[model samples]
Target chain A: MAAVEIHQFAECITCHAWSPDQSMIAFCPNNTEVHIYKLLADKWEKVHVLYKHDQIISGIDWSVNSNKIVTVSHDRNSYVWSQEASEWVPTLVILRLNRAALCVQWSPKENKFAVGSGAKTVCICYYEQENNWWVSKLIRKKHNSSVTSVAWHPNNVLLATTSTDGKCRVFCTFIKGVDKRDLGEGSSNDLKFGEQIAQLDLSVTWAFGVRWSPSGNTLAYTGHNSMVYFIDDVESSPSAQTLALRDLPLRDILFLSERVVIGVGFDCNPMVFTADETGLWSFVRYLDERKVAPTSSKGSQFSEALGKLYGQSKQSTSNDTVEPSKFRGGAHANCITCIVLLRRSAATTVKRFSTSGLDGKIVIWELDNSIDIQQPGYR
Target chain B: MAEEGFLEVENLEAIITRIEQKSRKIESLLKQSKPVEALKTALEGSPLKTRDERCKSANWIVVHRAMMAIKDVDAMFSSLDPEYYDILMKYLYRGLATGDRPTCDQCLRIHEKLTERAGLGCILRSLADTVNTV
Candidate 1:
């Protein structure tokens, strides 16, 4: 069973981040105030409130290894918070942008982080010990529109940034003092700071989500055209292959393995896709499709609700067609905005993953070993 | 593997049911000769629940065509999803008035930069009107 908890009522949760131990959660309730809550006795206790940003907070990412919370906001500023005694202290980051910041992400190595902004810039921010504050370098030449999301490469030197221009661009964010070595032999960039070498524009619609594969060999992004594309970073000019999807467009995605990925969005469910024997990635099955039967309708005078109340209906029994139910047989009530891969010992399989969304629910779903996704159709 | 575009039996049934329900509303409005209100409900009833930009944009694109089918951009805007008012404005600013992309599919074509952020045109005009009255 998937354990789901409703955090707020009718308010969209813009973004969320969990601590390393998964005991505490930091989320912005589509407001300027950032709420930090801890898990106590199977219930969430509001531990502290970090009220600083003047505008609504856009995104939050908790650094697992560093125990720091970094947030970017519509006010065009970013802050890193660390617990001191009983309160959280906020250190201002010099983003130096003209427009609102959309999202923030920390690198795996925890030495640096990246912020995607509406100013068509991805600010690769790092702590400047000399000044005792974090500062950002601008990557603005290639992107022609607002950058929506940013993901850090596994090596912590590369950054994948997506924008409204239907393109996903990768930049080498190697700061002199932060990165000790040069770019890998397989990387396409020139190992220079803020140089974009791999520019794979899907040529369909904007890419709102981008994730670097765990191995850092491939980059996957969800396009606005209901298409998922993966770019191999090894080629002189990285080539992108679109992952086939017959359903609605995906908003967010995560790499479960080098070959398998989980995409969640308007579908109100998480879908698992895996690369075939020939290395072609294909949709495997919906991990949340627990219902095999149609819902029972209210017999007499019928008026069923619609909107974010139900999933996209597939098919049903009886020739007349039955109405879709509110999150009937699915785990989420509405569009899933984000998915976080939980603690896992294996690279190819995920023991657990959590999803939070517009429905105001954060759900943790555990995977069953019986449904092996490597097989073409696990269902 | 399942066939392309293949939905499960239950899903298909529920989808058909939802379609039938909307069709009934469209039919009743036509019978009452209030196609504008009929179209208004359709546009207002859009799936903002998707929250995904592509899905939300796609839903509005379909509603845009429905408005074009009725040829009443005013009524469509009157009951437009406030969340998508900017999307519709951007669609118009880019002169996608014909409801056809360069690729000719439902794929995205117009640039979001084309929008005139709360300028004299679009809803800002109505907002100005209300402000004057108050």
Candidate 2:
């Protein structure tokens, strides 16, 4: 079993993000305020509180290279935060969205970001040096329903989005002035701005989280109906494979490697899925090792026997310190909403990740690949 | 009031007559050892749209007969189209709901093979759909 670390944050965390150096953390406590915590010796100390949005914050992303934080909320606005001296300041972006924004993510180059909204559009926002503010360009008329999540491809040009319309689409977000003429190979350079490259209709229900693999060769997303789809060959013919899970639906997913992915959501346990030598995807195991409650059958039986010998003495059952009623087996007691990669050994392989959810607890999990417990089709 | 009730009864009778006709054709195909064609005919024009219990049960009997008559599970699934997987799952659930020992056993046997052939999405879609209840 992997080593597990737990932290108590708030009543409920809507979303969270880690700093570039992994020293401090920021999260929304299911409210309008965003709290930034600094690690102080053995406990976390509240260092900053960002209060600008009038509604609940939905998504937050801390840029890895430039060390900037971007946040979106249901108030149809987004803010980019930068550190000045000892305080963080917010720069408002004119998203021009009429409805609430659902999710946000920065591009691989940190030059732009995308915000999905209930207005059936994605706002690709970038810094404007002349205006001294961030401006957005709308990709409209492609999504017929509310856009739920957005993920950027590694090439920094192609953006993948999932929506309530039961479709995942890959669109080119290349702007002439902002993007270079020639990206790397397979950068989808020929497509115009906002041109959709592919639309995958594998789910019959609302699709939620979406992530592109490290190599940008495959795309994965989850549906409300407890199904996950992986599509390959995005620029050309897109082929898809669907894996239906028996547990509750997943809200978010992260690609640990090119072959491994960790999915977390309503099941309250992080699930791992891996691909084999033939590239056949299958469910492997859950990261949550449900700890056996202290009240084992043998212990219960002994207590019962002792009670019988003592002629119906009630103290034996009540003497136990651990309340069995509140003892849940898994680490999380509620739905898991977000998962972020905390540490990675290399670009392609992940070493550590953190998951937080409605339970208001953040659980850090380490991946131990040395065991090679490749129990394929074990589900 | 009596006339409207009588018209609904007549509509149900017509639906039952059509179902029985289809059932006869499916039985004939099954006798010829063509279970795939029999299953295909059984799934067409399912009575799930109608709220009448008689029409649904009559159509379900036809579907259950065709499903149980098959001997080779893999051969039938190999030739089956993906479009029919969801409908087959619905009928299988209905068969299991009947609570008969042999019927449930047969339904579970087919359900396992169906899930293996068509991923778990087939079962999820079948269960999630509220419009087409068998």
Candidate 3:
């Protein structure tokens, strides 16, 4: 049996992040405010409400090392919230973009963060200790459309981003003052800041979620076309493989390990993809194993009369079609938008991961260790 | 601002002219009984960038003709490059949208073969893409 924990936090959550110790979560409830809830005793209690942005909060990430929360908003601003005493203080990062900020992520080192924007640019921001402020350098002109998501390689210097223009690109985000020159090897060490390193145009439709494996040798991303593309040997000769899913398109993806990936989206269930011994990725199975109830052919006369009455009231509709069900027969009743790693069994293996979606419920899924290690390609 | 506007219009005209030339070339290739080359030409610069009905219809006519002229379905599909799969699917859908009986029949035949060869990603990419339309 799959071990899972479900918590309903809001009516609809746009984005969410877990605290370092997994005691608290900060999530945007499809609004301009950020609500931080603490797991008190056995119940979740509201602890803080972060209100600074003028528009809807699009993305949020909590730093694992620094315990700071970084948020980006559609208002074209980003804020880094650090706890001082008991209150959280917000410091604004100067992201000079004329378009809305779409997504943000803290790099592995927690030294700098990258924010994707609608202006076809990504702003890599880092703190200037001398000035005590965050300054950003723009990665410009590479994307033909809005940058949808950003993921950092384990080295924290190479950044991968997906765009609406049907491309996923990896860029060198190593700033002179913020990063060590010799910290990264191969192409990451040699490329200048904001230089495009590799571009993957395997998807012919809008690409949404992107993630790098823990080893940073492989990258995976999802397209709106209900396909997932996995690229191996990204630094050298990049080879891409595409897996087409039969369900609705995935909006976000997470790497559980180098060989296992969990993708969630409009399908309302997390689907797993695994690489074989030959490193060819294929769809495995859904984490949610609940059998969807088949639609009944026989309709009750009362409901049929009601359907006709509703159609007559609306006047423009046919009486034959009934409204679609709100229940998708999965753990999430709506489209899942975000998945964050919660705990790890080892440096490379994920133990527990949490996913939150439009249903406003956060589901914590724990992977059975025995089954994971027995997989064909899993180490 | 005025210069930028004029440049945009001039660029659109150039694209339309280029598409027309490619369409005529595809017709000539079909006349020469080179269905494979004709199909290649039809898929070269697709999907047409312009939303102009005339440019789209002319390209579709050429693509439909090349697809119908092919005698060996399996041989043609076996030789077709994987890179052209998504574009070919798009043209098939555009052909289906015409609602003409022959065009729909030909497009359905090719669509079935292409989906079998390329798997489901080809169809998904064609339907999901809102940016690049034929």
lDDT of each: 0.68, 0.84, 0.83
Runs in model 2 lying further than 4 Å from the true structure: A290-328, A345-350, A372-379, B1-22, B25-61, B64-124, B127-134
Residue-by-residue lDDT tens digits, candidate 1, A228-298: 88887533557668764545567899887787788988767788877766667777777764333332242
Model 3 CA lDDT for position A6: 87
Tens-digit lDDT track for model 2 on A1-379? 4437888899899999999888888999999989999899978999999999999999999999999999999999999999999999999887999999999999999999999999999999988778787889999978999999999999899999999998899999998778996885654868888999899988777899999999998899999878889888877888889987766789999998888989999878888888887778888887775333422333444445543644333346664424423333577878999999886436542268888899899888887654433543223
Tens-digit lDDT track of model 3 for A1-379: 3437889999999999999888999999999999999989899999999999999999999998899999999999999999999899999997999999999999999999999999999999999999999998899978999999999999889999999999999998878877888864455667888888899988878899999999998999999898899999887899999877655789999987788888989877787788888999988777774332431222434346545654565566544233322222567888999999886436643378889999999999877544853444200
Q: For model 3, what is the error of residue A212's alpha carbon versus the real structure, in angstroms, after optimal superposition?
A: 0.8
Worst 10 residues of 2 chain A by lDDT: A290-299
Best by DockQ: 3
Question: What is candidate 2's TM-score against the reference?
Answer: 0.76
Q: Quality of candidate 1's docking, in CAPRI categories?
A: incorrect
Task: Encode model 2's per-residue lDDT on B1-134: one tens digit a residue.
Answer: 67756765778878888889999999899889999999999998887655688788889989989988888887888788877887899999999888999889889888977876665657777776654578
Best by lDDT: 2
How many angstroms is the interface RMSD of candidate 2?
6.9
**What level of docking quality does candidate 2 show?**
incorrect
Off by over 4 Å in 3: A294-328, A345-350, A372-379, B1-92, B100-123, B130-134
